[model samples]
Target: MIRFVFAALLSVAAATAQAEVDIQEVTSPGGINAWLVEDHEIPFLALEIRIEGGASLDLAGKRGAANLMTGLLEEGSGEMDARAFQTAREGLAASFGFDNYDDSFSVSARVLTENRDEALALLRAALIDPTFDDDAVERVRAQVLSIIASDEKNPNRIAGAAFDAAAFGDHPYGSSLNGTAESVAALTRDDLITAHRNVLTRDRVYVGAVGDITAQELGVVLDDLLGDLPQSDAPLPEDVPFGLAGGVTVVPFETPQSVAYFGHQGLKRDDEDFFAAYILNTILGGGSFESRLMTEVREKRGLTYGVYTYLVPKDHAEMVIGSVASGNDRIGEAIAVIRDEWARIASDGVTADELSAAKTYLTGAYPLRFDGNAPIADILVGMQMTGLPPDYVINRNDYVNAVTLDEINRVAGELLRPDDLHFVVVGQPAGVENTN
Candidate 1:
């Protein structure tokens, strides 16, 4: 009987996984818009909200203010202090999260259908009425300082910081999200308040929702939660031109293994050849065990335990970046192999067999991401942020499969820059030297 029950549960899960989500574009009376997916199978709802201009909007000399402000959103609001706010959220069995990234501030919430109204009221309080109390600011400031201190000693963090500095110079993109200890220590309640005002504006907001809710109800909820935010007049950071020349930047440290962060200019998201470039990158390095980088660097040569690459399509800049760690003596050899593979892939694209395999795996794996409400909500919001069409969820894999070998090869030749790649090596390496 137990085995039979387990089998039945698996069948149900499979059916749920195969269910299609119907998306609706909702516009509130207050002129707010949201993408919504209604699913009554679950008695809960997931909402994701994004406000453009996150840490990048921090005022001059006040870096990390946005991050600190986001962290303090739920610390207190209206009549509720931090402890009282926690109790209220727990009483409704709901979850609320606020976070700040380089380009956006995000709020995520999950609440039972019956409790959604009360939960949204609480969310509204947090969003529009955050007190940014003195004690709360100081407490969160200390917490952020602790994190900044910890990152100072992290090798990956060091490499990333150096890479950003080299690539972006004095642009906001080059600055750390968590400002220096001195800058953070100097932050005041006024900075947090101004940062909040600059970030949470109606003009920069995108929202998505999933689960047991009607479009009409969602429209009302949207207005109630976000209707009062002021229109943002603050200017976002300007585009950062790629500045790091082809070279090695060595930051001496005392570690047996060296971590290197390397990258060059990348194609924009809206470029017509983006799909082709995406497929080409998969063949070169984006694919984990099956990629050329992983195969040559780890499997055959065994220079490193792991290596990976990704495309960063940010609002202001684009990049094709990657990282690897190996013994100090072997890192130079690994770097040489990486450069060789990069050039080879640029000169000759993937084989027909490889392209077919990439298509099959990518298409098959895409649907697995929408098996839950939160994941669906996330995809919806991301689509809006990247300016994707409402039907993108259904049509994304088609674009991937439609990429031709000729197109991939052309894109690879144009996009890959083996000579222009810059490496920030953070460790004591034997053979590598500063080439800049």
Candidate 2:
């Protein structure tokens, strides 16, 4: 009853916040396409740009080159040195950020209407003519090396790295985005230049803009900003063969609590039954306090402080992963409970009441994501990159609501692999031995 009331209140809040958001697909004179949501009410504009094939496109020998190159983008560009570039940005009172992830390189910028053109020019310079100065390369390389060193002693990182290696084998996805200390130390300025050119190309780019910009003006901005990037000739990574064999692989570490990373193969984002599988996951573990995993492992038995699961639908691979940390003595019990819950959900599915509650929370919480212009712009670019239709923003909640119990159960039975679940435990946990 309490769950139902919370869901009802959230549904009301979502309905109240639902305003008509008009998205226009604009094509620039130079043939660049972008999604735009114009709101003249705000004096600021937020722009988001994504280039697919991010760090995954790094050269075979240089694992961290793409990541290093992304950091250097703002260090210096064209004629402006690092200090001069920053001074110019501060003068305009604008913000720009560049980031490299496993599958994409993203640029986010926010600027007042009066300084939009200047911000765009600065962004263009960074993208087109990055200096990759010798000093900047060494400086950023040291920072990355520091992080890699720190990750070596982090149990969670250790477990994740081991899990990826076991699941992906020789695939590039198995490798860390930051690369090893030796690999990063060996990176050169020329490598950074090549990585920059290979990853940030016109063919792989997607753009989304929101705020006080018209379609005509946005089209002009798109062309002026990205028209000159080299056409992408870089080959994308191949699909990873799913090879996550079941059983625990324990890395002995001295800690009071054992942290475990566990999962099995998962469905792709474009699968017809994705919505059903999504809701099934919610009832099982995606929901926080109300989820079966949390309720069983944390609320009832207190085996762990928290436990959760999520789906990772990458461009080249898909996975359903989860994690939990518990006292060494009780970690085994927690793992058993998680596995039991997985099997039960697969066989029995969720109840009608559970289904209704999942739908309410999922749909109601979605509208909260659109609270800001920058966030909306980010979502728009992500939608384009993922091949979602322009109306996805408006119809997404309907898709969640349309899921029925039958569909959810059928998907659960098809997708869950209790016997094939793999676990990587990182700590000295009693009764948990390495089975690799």
lDDT of 2 at 376: 80
- Give TM per candidate: 0.96, 0.95
416 in model 2: Cα distance from truth in Å? 0.8
- Give candidate 1 misplaced runs (Cα > 4 Å): 1-15
**CA lDDT, every model vs. true structure:** 0.89, 0.88
Steric clash pairs (candidate 2): none
**Residue runs of model 2 more than 4 Å from their true location after superposition:** 1-19
Model 2 scores a TM of 0.95
Per-residue lDDT of model 1, residues 1-436, tens digit only? 4334434433443456633568899999989999998978666788999999999998899999999999999899999999999989888877899999999999999877777899999999999999988888889999999999998898889999999988998888897988889889999898988999999999899999988899999999999999989899889999998899888999998889999999999988989999888887787889569999999999999999888888899999999999999999999999999999999988887788889988988888888888777778988999999989988878888899999888888888899989999999999999999998
Cα error, candidate 2, residue 63 (Å): 0.3
Summarize candidate 2's per-residue lDDT along 3-117 as a digit string, tens digits: 3443443343334343346899999999999999997865678899999999899888899999989888889999988998998887777788999998999999887788789
